[model samples]
Target: MSVETDSHGRLYLSSELRQKYGEKFHIVEYEDRLELVPIDEDPLQAVREAAGDAFEGESIEELRERAREQAKEDAEAGFERGKRTAEGGNE
Candidate 1:
């Protein structure tokens, strides 16, 4: 998705990204691109900063793999949320 800046050069968030990342992630719109953030910062930090209980016992490599999986899940969830909202938020 893309965002248009105002005449005063203020960055405007893409509602598209917001709706998509509902409870999963967030996108910070910049003049040229967007920065992504996780919904949960994983305050637990028992392992990697992003690992939860399901991964507390995993190896470092395993934890990386799990992080990838979780990121994909969050992205898909966000995309679906965006789709639903695009369909008039009836979902």
Candidate 2:
């Protein structure tokens, strides 16, 4: 199928396409081309499916704590990486 953008540069997908692929999409742009990735209609369900068995026996509080710790660790690692990059390190 062929698609064209309007003067406002907004491209509208056909209903047929929308039915096949969801109503929402993630537009990915590369140096050469663009791609439209369909997004999950129910993101929480997708997360649960993806996270199978990882947090099977964990309580809500335990999950929250783990999330917090992971976020902190990720932030610290990012900060360290940024610092090294700024200090002329290739890391």
Candidate 3:
């Protein structure tokens, strides 16, 4: 179906289209065209779907602890790498 924008350059979707797709959309613009992508209304559910089983049996507290430990390890590794770089080491 063909759609047109108003004088203000705003396009309106028909109720049929809205019901078929969604109320919320992300407009992607290419050099020569525009496309609309439907967005999930429930953002947390979307994240859960995308994450899949990555967090499987882990509790929130366990995840937080793991994140903190990983951050500390990353900081220490970065510091050691910087030290070695400053000392002209290949490590």
Candidate 4:
């Protein structure tokens, strides 16, 4: 239940405490205190770790570009799948 500040003076989760909890927790800020809620390891870390620095502190323009790229990829994938299905599911 201690407070910690990062290099930029922003609050940060304690790595030691997180490790002690076996990497299964959710941090919630309630009123003036921080609360830790236990969550299963997967949902707790999967999305975040998978996401990585993809959008970390990115600006609106950068995020829009990423979104555009993702949408283009998705559309291309869908078109490929449709083409395959139309072609009797050929590889």
TM-score of each prediction: 0.38, 0.61, 0.56, 0.39
Give lDDT: candidate 4, residue 71. 100
| Model 2 steric clash pairs | none
Model 4 residue runs over 4 Å out of place are 1-54
Question: How many pairs of residues collide in each model?
Answer: 2, 0, 0, 0
RMSD (Å) per prediction: 15.3, 4.8, 3.6, 12.9
Worst 10-residue lDDT window, candidate 4:
40-49
Instruction: Tell how far residue 2 is off in model 4, in angstroms.
Output: 43
At residue 24, what lDDT does model 4 achieve?
58
Clashing pairs in 1: 20-78, 20-82
Runs off by more than 4 Å, candidate 2: 57-62, 73-91
**Candidates ranked by TM-score:** 2, 3, 4, 1
State the local distance difference test value for candidate 2: 0.89
Per-residue error for 50 in candidate 4, Å, reads 16
Candidate number achieving the greatest TM-score relative to the actual structure: 2
Residue 27 Cα positional deviation in candidate 3, in Å, after optimal superposition: 1.2
